[model samples]
Target: MSEASKHKAYAQRDGLNHVALVCDDLSSTEDRVPKYFEIYSHADYELGKRFYFHDDDGTEYEMVC
Candidate 1:
């Protein structure tokens, strides 16, 4: 097995409101959304979208955008 498979990450929960990302103004994070979650990159954070993504190790990050 390669080094990439030596260790892995997983999600601990699955449901609505799994995570809460508090921000003063969600719009500021617009440009950076893609680096994390590709799905919300063009969805317009102003629409009040729920975005999620995982790091290289598969650790999930859910943000209420």
Candidate 2:
């Protein structure tokens, strides 16, 4: 079976709060990282805007929030 076939979904649960992505350098990670990810949904915080990057990474991350 393929990678996708190996996994199965059942039900939906509560939404996610936040995620942390590993990077060689957080400073440049934002600028250097490719723009393959797009905003699926978002919210505003006291610090800044929170954007959700949609990809095959299995989870969403706050890239430029």
- The TM-score, computed over Cα atoms with residue i paired to residue i, of candidate 2 is 0.38
Q: How far is candidate 2 from the true structure (C-alpha RMSD, Å)?
A: 9.5
Model 1 per-residue lDDT tens digits across residues 1-65: 53223322133535332345655555566458776554322233674664455555445554555
Q: Which candidate is the best by lDDT?
A: 1
> Candidate 2: where is the Cα deviation over 4 Å?
1-18, 21-34
RMSD of each: 8.5, 9.5
C-alpha RMSD of candidate 1: 8.5
Count of clashes in candidate 2 = 0
Q: Which residue pairs in candidate 2 collide? A: none
Candidate 1 Cα outliers beyond 4 Å, as residue runs:
1-19, 40-49
